[model samples]
Target: MSGCHDCADCPAAKFPPPPAKAAHVIAIVGPPNSGKSTLFNRLTGLHQKVANFPGVTVEHHVGRLRADTDREVLLVDLPGVYSLLPHSEDERVTHDVLTGLRPGMEPEAVLLILDCTNLGRHLLLAAPILNLKLPTLVILNMADDLRNRGGQVDVAKLSAELGAPVALISASSGEGVDKVYQFIQGTAAGRAKVKAPLIQLPVLQDIPKCRRWASEVGAGAAYRAPEPPRWTRRLDAVFLHPWAGPLIFLAVVILVFQSIFAWATPVMDGMKTLVEASGAWVAPHIPTPLLRSLVVDGVWSGVGSVLVFLPQILLLFFFIGILEDSGYLARAALIADRTMRKFGLQGKSFIPLLSAYACAVPAVMSARTIENKRDRIATIMIAPLMTCSARLPVYTLIIAAFLPNRPLLGPILGTQAAALLGLYVLGFLAAVLTARLLKSSILKSGGTPFVLEMPPYRWPTLRSISLRLVDRARVFLRKAGTVILVVALLLWVAAHLPLQNGKPPEIGQSFAGQIGHAMEPVIKPLGFDWKIGIGLLTSLAARETIVATLGTIYGMEGEAASHGLQQALHADLTPGGALALLIFFAFAMQCMSTLAIVRRETGGWRWPAAQFAYMGLLAYAGAFLANQLAGGAVTRLIAFLQ
Candidate 1:
């Protein structure tokens, strides 16, 4: 349990409230895709923090709502589920909390968010929850969608059918949602009633009785249904077409990648210019040489190199937001479902896998949504291979270095966009293929069918998109501001140390260079030298640190440091080295944070250790192959052009 700190004489502690003054708990439970998350966000807004349920890795969102007169409502949004009879880990978690079976969890009331258009079916879930006798309110989201389709749920009759107040609302549009919140605040203390199941339990087939009773209740409530699923059928035809759907999904992904490079170029350039100007202005004013160097080259330059990529990161999130909020991502999942089944995964795994492109840690966390154990573990295992945004910096740099930007497939698509698209495709292929291997060999699990509702397309609100954008920017900057900052300072010291005999320290003789040199022999096979070795070593903390590490290393050099990193690489690295490094990063397990999260999720070092070993081998092999193959192709192409 969580409580508000600002409230005067708040009766509860932050968590695990004393039994005598047990904190009021309200559970927001619903079936999957029933607008559970949307309602939670609307109720709590950005004032929410997620923490795991007592002992489980499954996290619940806790938020506060203003209640009647100088108090706040503590809201716990539970995992989405079909019924209290749990089949999945998440469903089990919800059931335990509601039943007081799980330790440290006791709910005082429940808010049931149901899909309005399918009230009869959604209420089948409500019957059991209602029997718990917790003060409950039924929020029928998608009421607007239902109404537009010439359907309506009779609220007055529904309030009578179930012994709970019913609110007709569209969580997306904020229609009647306030009433639901007010109901929670007003009734949590005394309204919830624990009682027997509403309909008599059937002797042998209780499930069918539940269904029949739900239909009967629908009739009693005068539940109105919309027009037949004609448009949905038609839309599914094109979007879920056996062959065309996948192609459309592919095109959408390609467009996103192209936009990342094409749309963000000007912004990226502007950021680069700003950093250079700041460096120029700030560097000469400092009095001491070492202090000035640390401020300019170590701090600003290292941080700036990574920060310039924020535009591309933001643009990527922007497009992803559109896809998700538009409901097309669900269709994309449906389209991928066919191939996913062949690999022993259902469509449920697709969301987490898709989310991996943003970052693997959260994607892995999102795997809790998947019901099956093996399926969840499998998703977590291959999630890191999804070509996350951290790879964007490395990819952009390498593509700029090795690949010429000639227009291909006419003037619209360039070699740069195509190459970038190709890398993402490679990552997808790698993830699917690796999952197949793991499913058949290590994990050895049977396939589970994917069950999901295609949420109606809602135009994403500016507020929603803006909130997400702010959250993403904060995460990116926090990583840059903290981890990269510390690493940059350390790398600066490493590159500037060991001055001896009154002569200036050389990078090759400094501690950092010596460390890089030690690993140089090992990495030389993959077309890397000591400087790249240093970047690779530093990147164990974070993938983005490679850029900062390289910036710090190069910034320390006398004349070479004056050149931009791209130019320095152009003069120093061969096309083969650039391609090989790109391939390595595309496949490598570079982020220690990802591995740590995996270990935590899997509950042991065994899985993360195996993940590290296999991913490392693959990265090394991939880099070596890229070096050889790309080197051969470049030589032959040059000969032909000559």
Candidate 2:
């Protein structure tokens, strides 16, 4: 039952009964970041099942891969782990399933996904699989990436050393997949357990021997690496340089933020024109003012609100996909490690926090990679404090309206971009502080050391990155369609209903307006008016909803110009109030989706509830400071200039 081997004692060896007809279970196992998920996506494409692995929250994906005319291989994508020796939930789940020890689950064969880019370390995991004596096919994923990066893997010798088939395939490009089917068809080898050399000891002393054995097996495959990790080393030289590395990373981050506003401006303006044109064309044609009002103000306004954010969302995800695929994020993580350790996190935390800029739900979920319970929870708790894309619309709305588009420091960076960058930096600082507090107080499993595997660099296909971008857009649009759309509908209904003296209702007299008024006492000290109060209340569901809610709220008041909301925000909000609002959103865990995900990932309500409370207090305090500090400073500067 030991996960280390599929010998005579293994359940897999006994169950199939030497009959080729017996259902052959195939498990895909690997170290983290080896593109196993990418391979799973290719092999199972739209034909997969996702469920919990027995008692744990970790997902188990089961899919069918065709073997031949007679049989279909059941492919289980085991959770990525380092070795058969269990340390975390992922490792435990993977081990139980591979050993056939978990109730009703026994994988008869294994497709060990090894990184050709890092074969030596991968062999540490692969060695134990070979010991299981089960038919093991070592898959060299990212082989193309390795070769392109000036590295090589001797598949022939690797197969010989392990007595198993090895396939070099670029799972990302969908290349060399047929080799897998062909190998499965030849299934004569690997079905019966071989007497793989067994390690003599389970104690700590023998760990080096296992790794040494792995090293020896790897040596035959030239796992010693056929050549110096030339390109990787060169790239690392610049990217991981003590001075250049941090500088380059900061510049890249700034460039990413600048492009979000710069590149997306054209599309955003175009959408505004389209929405205005559509509203203008359709508004005059309707015979009745009531129907016309609903058509123009309710639906179009709601739809238009969400549309404004589309460009930013699409571009943000596109950049993230490129950075992730190019393997530069690993470099970024490395660079961030020292800084992260200061805040009670490590390099491993940087990716999820970076991802939080796009959205916090997946970022919180990504924290599971930390393995340490306290660190994982701390990461989750502060992930929302990162400047997610949802906050982009709100930031832009406030900035574009109030802040002049004048150049800062003589045109290299504009005031708006600088302000935007400052907000991002602010969010990062807040997250660092929050993590420090959590680690020092609530979650004090301090400072666990971890290694980040740097994957080989490749020219990732634009098509693949685009496909991923499209997926992100789909998720955003799905939320827009479901949650934002419903909230918009309700807001519209509340604003238009309860007519005053048989005429159109004044928005201030409507149901939503009353709610906004009730919230005014709480928001007033922060310099926000009742209308801002309404947007704040509505946006509790989704951060981006603030933009749409503001758009809808203004549209209800019959504000119709293309730049109407922007101008309105400029006119309605004092510089202090606007700054306060932006600062508030910078720290607020306002997205219900983020809260729900934290609940699911933590398996309780307590953490999510705590997250909401602590983040709320931070948002309030931060806003109060921004209101007091920025408002007075701006006024004094204005007076001095005058």
Candidate 3:
């Protein structure tokens, strides 16, 4: 500054000083499964913006809340970290933001959330954060659980001992959250303050010293850790059993698979009917043939194909939420750890992979929590292989067209549901094989022991589950309205170009058809025709886009009917071809967003390029083999039966 001031006559003097940050940023930090996200959702409600932090792959969420005076305050929900030490990318980003090392994201205050039931242990994290001398509110979450388990802590004493205010709140239930808001309001008004500790804190760099100091502080406050919940222990005994656990998990998977097919069919049929009706009603009103085709065949048919899967997607996420809220997913992770290690992956990889079933983008981002570099890369590489919700539309369309919905095993399972479950297992097996190969080769690294905190099981609240579904629905509809809509419109335009006698030409004679024809020979071995080739090209934008592409193509070709996309596909595909298509999608890296995320997470195109190429080859080979073998088998079965 002195040098710059002295050079006032220089061009540098014309530059203005950097604008001082004015927003009061309050950071919410806690260890994993401590209900931090629940609290964030509670405080922010629907007013939040999500983006990546500068120069990092980590996601950032900033939400606005109104203070007592009606002034706005910004809350930054940081990644959950056990410590301020930079062990993983998540921890590093949190550490940077808290320490002001991350430009423009420094927090004015901290909401240090701790699991109240395990306060003594969670207190260890408070030392380094308190030393930062930020106006901090040490929030002991899960107050209801703590009291129910017969634990107690003198909040005033704890506040005095730690030299910061403490608030006992159940973030999930919203009890005592008002105090958190008050602390936020006070901090925003510059009224919040922290006193000198009653006992001197150890240096931030000294782990053992800090641990001892934290324990002493807790004792001074008369903190008592809660006894483990009885049902939790009992359930753990069964759910964590080596053999029974896997069996139980298998049963749960089967139930979910059955429910997806059994329960969602009615809703899907209703939605399909509604979409068709809308397209029919709108078509006549449009008057112009070209405009009518664009509106009905392009927009309506395209988006509608993907929209029909909304019920199934929501159903999948519903089970995931219940399992997670019930605290069973943590147990599932522990059970999967034994098998994961054999494939050169740790238990942490399983979480991202499990989440990959919902979507791979967030799952890849979730791998940031894994401390090991090689493990994180391996998780990201194989994440796309999992059968995500996007594949549901295509899978269902193909299955309904070819596979009969007859009972298997006395109606506990059905042919359609079994086929769906088989596809899921197929994806998981492919992921494991790929992970093993990666770990054996370039990404080879020694294993890191898995450690996880098991949260106490609780009944999932209706509010939380509904909020999750609503959020998912929002994302789904937004994609349909934007990306899918645009693709559908483009496809329609391409199909109508080079008009004959000022009317649209046959789809096979249009520009889109030419591209599909050119690619047909390349995919012919896999039993895909030019129409499927066109769908495949569009699907690169997203795994679900193929449904929209096919919907538009078939609608324009006058093949779609009252039965919709499934009926249209039945005429175009053989049983072997449909099975091959499912296999191809199960293995392929069909999502561009996933590739972009991989590139960002890996910090280069080299990894994503290699990933795309490897998966592409595997998908091709798998589909080709399935088409050849299954084709002959199916043909022979028909002849033999005759």
Candidate 4:
């Protein structure tokens, strides 16, 4: 009866067994930039899932820990709170969860993370938490920072005064982490309890007596006359300069994007070739045409489409990680705050908007950092306009095939690269316009004042960066994997069905072709053919799937251009057609995964459905105009030349 039971039915016995000790729910709480997330990551590794607390937009990260021989604990990384009194949705969720007032959950232990150097201010939240009487532990994180500053904490003495154990842990370096884990298990299992001095409470505020205890315990832990690092001061001068900071940030962003394209070209080419070779290798071995098409056209093309963007995505994250680690991101946020306020957005929304350029999934998720509901929703709505990497293949292919390589402003930049840059600018402008429009009309609200904590610059650890890269890649592959696989197979079937007189049917006669033909008139004015129409249809599965859809529809085996696929497309598609296709891809709601996530985030299908409808209309209208303009221009130029 005392042991854990796997079954639901307890033999209808005389006495109900005492409830097994409830598993301890430890909440990790601290201020922003206090290494709380880092500690959570180190403890949980990859065993964490992100979800929103019920009825709230705030994200909740939950992970399990095997603390001791037989004890399992659930660790919750609560949103960083500056105080116990909630000022934002994130803080409210944290507060509710801690007080057991959330819809249906309660934490049994609170792990208050305090920065060793800033303990005076960080202990404000800890004082209130101790009053909850939920068995607390004080984790003096960044202990190494104290030592670096010519200071040290007397942990044993600190524990004696605080009425609880104090562990001097360096979350980043894993110093003293095991001891903290051991203490958690020991306390949860009731094997040992430290009875240190308690801070007497004043009946009014329910303040715990632990303040005095902590003060006594931490008396020698305090130090004075710590020298500031010269390099940090020098770096901050240039990085946080009011006049030149914004300009430098912009230049850095442009350089990163340029590098993404330039550096990833060779790797992307190699992937394309590999995919093609893989298709060829598997083709002869597969017996059925259906199976062959499924493997070569569906699976290879779909996976390849996702892989092509890997380089750009990784590059974006690389720069993001560096900026985040170097503490430049917070400064950037500060610089952008005034500008963002005009559009009813917080400065924190800037990163998410920037990230949307790579993909909207992370961008939308990143919106959690934006505290206000209005800002978060407005940010989400405009995220798709940020030119995600899924649109890159379409943009590059069109530019290569139709746009001349000649430079517009002399020889410094190619016309194609210029156009690519224009597209990025266009996406940014569209997002800005859309956000403003939404704010003024549908989601009007005051912007949240930005008060971001700017941490000191630090050398980014390779281990952390590597882990983030792997985590992002794994997430991308997983989300795009199954959906891509099924869609690919369906596309192949659509493009290769109904053999006619022992001859493999031409695309025009295949199922996809017929469907495209049926919708031709609807899109004909925009210069798209039935094949392009079919590609657009399959794109609903995922925006990147458009490339694979085209590959399959063109009777190509894999992700790469076949012997004549590009040439054939160029010959068949007028300049207007290319422009129209590019415009469509730029604006269309083509990612199903994005829609699903939006639904989950917004708590209903209403917003997502509206998003799809409005975006679809915008795509069609934009593409129509682009086609007319580009087609007329091409015709006039050709005539003049003749």
Candidate 5:
């Protein structure tokens, strides 16, 4: 009844044929913990771009093959998933793209990367993908690890079993990756040649059938699963123990905090001297007074202050990258599950929360992997409460100014490092309490099971860790140049306005001063003066902006003009005010970028609005209390010592 009587006269006959050999756009996909990302980086190097998929906050990496030829292949590194079935946002994006249902360049072929050491389970994912029947090359990554551990797999036999070509490579060390390039180019060239289409395999509709198929395919291919490494089992015995595990994790945290101060001090000082020398060298070149002031006092001083802490921030990320790449972070998550359950969160939330230490934007976006909506929102809501790198400048500035560098634990930890660690603990405690409150109230939901595959331990490669630090530094420097630079220029204009006799007014009578004075009454209870009030307002753009704001203001002031930021702050803020500032930053939601991402993730302004108001109120009350109590205690201690 629905037959097309005019089939020969259809629109297909009128339109021109598609290209003979279109540019190849291959997809690199695999299960979590597979060496897919490493392979992608190996093939693309620094010639890659990252952007979010359409209609979602999830990001995908697009890169061209780093080949020395005219022909190029565009590779989309889709989010890692175990199967094509859409359980979470990541899986859904991968599924849509592979199926040609999404608005993007459909993959001409797929590079199915999997860990050869664990072929039984990894091959389970191959079933659904092979049914799609695209030109697929099953890339068994970590071949060196497999062979070192006595695992063996016949690549030719495996290729025959799956009815697709296969290759083995060590993505980390760049071993045998040329086979990947060959396959890509060959697939592209083959597109122009006509051949008989292969018959489609029956669909794998259920997990049991898929599993049976995978097992049979493995048996046929002579796939031998690798023996678990001896060191991994031994390490797990201690690191994954019931009681000792958490204590070890705590010790690791303490070591990281102590090292942040002790190890990074000299590097920070060197950076500070370099910034000052550059400013001094350039200050005399500008002829006009206002131009000199803007260049030397405003832009250089403000941005330079934040740049000094780059060493400390990178040190923090260095440790994080090592922990993650070494596979200890996953074990840490398992250990934290017990405590997470007590606070109404699951173990799966730990990774995102831990990632928040570096930045909250990606941490929030990573929550798309959580299956439960309520649990996902709760993680998003509390992610900002973690002490991110933006808070490092404020914390280090205040701590270094007020707290002495006296050693608290001999050579292990110092007074300043202890103070920094306490601030971190305070933030984490606040996040847990807030999670408890939210989970018990509006966002309440039933507990969902958290199952994560434990990755084998491996020594972190230097190349990977260095790459991470480089990326972090680029992001930090970019912000300093753009956002911080623009803010400094605007502040300088405001601080020198309404000139009398064509000369700049004193800071007290300038437009910036009047604005700060108006807000002074509101922050007076927290031991803040007019200058700090101005810094607080500007900090809403970014938490690190407060440091830059203070730097610009102090550069304009006459007193302590030659001193560094630490001395300038000591001249203005009391010990209590210094403590209050740290407490305020720990509790406040001072990042506009974080707020915008939260709004996008939650799909409305309600969550971010509520989050902003709650954090603001908490910061004010906490700072007020610290000012009243700690101020007196510190004064008494100083007098007693004298």
Candidate 6:
């Protein structure tokens, strides 16, 4: 009989035949800044999920790996730990998972990833992990850096000394990654044997025997120091300076924002033309008025509204990847910490806040890294106020139509750019105030001490950055696409219902119109017509839906202009009305998806409901104040000129 068939005759096989395939659970562990996350991303590609552990705010990232023809491996990325003996909440998570003591899971094997250049220090944690008696593999990542520093490693000798499979890998370049996969496959097939490495820890006087063992095992595997990169040191000089660093960071941010509009203008204009042409094409062929309205007003308007901002979104993510990959993001956080702290936030909060500029869902999810309950909650609460890219469509439409193009003082501050800057400032102010209010009231509690590891600056791989950008774009298209589509259909149905006298009722007399008219008594004081009121209501599903809702309300012919929605609004709306609309969008909590994510993250409806309530009231108050002040000021200016 074949060796694989032996189990068929055994008593254990009475119920059913056991499959020959073996499943291995591999946990990847490393110290902070050791490229553990980069390795995880490389191995998993896009197949991963982030879940919360029971009763804790920590995130658990799990991905599946098919390492061989017969075996499937489950890869778990544990939080980075400084030592096996935990000192913080996140570190405890790592400790528990490694020891198979974590609440709901146990790993069958462990992959210990270490930075090659810092092997001596990394071995401190490796010693304790080895004592668990689990099958283990050691990966010396960043081998490229080691080789570039004129340092070399003898892999065969190192493996023999360490008593574990050892592989030298450059995670970013995918070098030596295949060897890791091969080793895992062999181990899962029961064809590979690894003895527990003897670890000698001279520094740990409390465990002399363990120390001696680690020393003997690590001797040949370790290498002498290599020269540090001169460019890293030179860049650090300017990037880490207390006074000059923040200024440089602000300048970079300004340039990135400016480039978003400047670089994406051509693509955006082309998309606008294409959308208008498509609308014109559909209008003539469709005979039924209702069907025609749905196609032109609902699908065309809504999808077109969101797609027009694709260029801006892509450009924003492109720069975000560059900053994150180049390691400037951490330095920016360090420099902004003092200012952020004054508002009851830590330096690490900058990551989530900055992420919110792309979208708030990921920003809230990223807040799990904040250990303190109070800080995490406060960060989640304020993240949505950070002017996400979705707001750009509304802002672009308003500013282009209403804001003058004249230069102020110099070319540096054109009136158009200045108005955009003012909106961002308002968003920042809103986030700061919201954070402060939450800290003192509902979320009043002390936060854990912030201790972040700053990684050395390195050149980000172009391939990796491009891949990440594409991944983010896909995610946006998937999640936001569905929500926008449904909301658009609903808006179309609402605005087109209750046909009167065999002709489709105008928007002012339809179902959405009646609702808006009923609410007009309240919103009219803010200078909003019923049409604008309807736009605000639909926008609650997603902020960008306002543009689509407006396009639909104005009818098909109006939406087909070269200037598109902006020109339509300029011809249709008075300056005071435009100002009121901008203010409304600026402060509104206009995304239900963000609310649902908050509920999931916070584990209750209380926080999300409260967030919606407060933001809605704030939006109304801000819009009312702006309309009154702006309208009165314009009237007085006109009288003065006359």
Using TM-score as the measure, which candidate wins? 4
Cα error, residue 71 of model 6, in Å, equals 2.5
The lDDT of each candidate is 0.74, 0.72, 0.78, 0.71, 0.77, 0.73
Instruction: Give the per-residue lDDT digits (tens) of candidate 6, residues 239-358.
Output: 877778878988876766566656766887799789979998989899988888889978887677566656666776677678777888778767778877898887767767876776
TM-score of each: 0.75, 0.71, 0.78, 0.81, 0.77, 0.76
In the range 1-642, model 4's lDDT, one tens digit per residue, is 223131221111212323664446678888887888888888877766554554555665676674453545667889887766676777788888889885334776778888877665566566667667777788989877777877666777666556777888898899999977876777667665535345442232333444443343356455232356556788889877876777897887677656665676688779878887888998999998767777877788777766765666676677777778778778777877888877767677787787787677666655655656777788988898888877887788777777767756788887788878988887788778888888887787755444677777778877677667776666556555555567667777777777787555787898878999999999899998888888888788677666666776666754366435667678878888887788788788898656755665665567778888878888899889988877888656534533
Question: Considering summed lDDT, which 10 consecutive residues are worst modelled in model 3?
Answer: 3-12
How many angstroms is residue 429 displaced in model 5 relative to the true structure, after the best TM-score fit? 4.1
- Model 1, span 156-229: residue lDDT tens: 88777776788899887889987886777566455545444435433322677778888887888888788755
lDDT, candidate 1, equals: 0.74
lDDT for residue 522 in candidate 3, whole number 0-100: 92
In terms of lDDT, which candidate is stronger, 1 or 5?
5
User: Per-residue lDDT tens digits of candidate 5, residues 1-642?
Assistant: 023232222222222224553446789989988988889888987656554554455556777787753345778899888989887788888998898876435888899999888888888788878867788888999999999999999988888777788899999999889999888877766652222213233356687777777778888888888888878898999998877888998887666656565676788779978887898899889998888888986788667755765776677678767877798877876877787778898766766676677667556755654556677889998899999877987898888777767776898998778889999999999999999999999888755456766788988888887776775565455543455566667777777887878888876678878889998988988999998987887787678777766877777432353248888888888888888999999999987656756765665578889999988998999999999888989657545534
Model 3 misplacement above 4 A: 1-22, 241-247, 346-429, 442-447, 479-481, 520-532, 538-586, 589-611, 621-642
- Comparing candidate 1 with candidate 5, which one achieves the higher TM-score? 5
Q: Sort by TM-score, best first: what order?
A: 4, 3, 5, 6, 1, 2
Best by lDDT: 3
The per-candidate count of clashes, in order, stands at: 4, 3, 0, 5, 0, 8
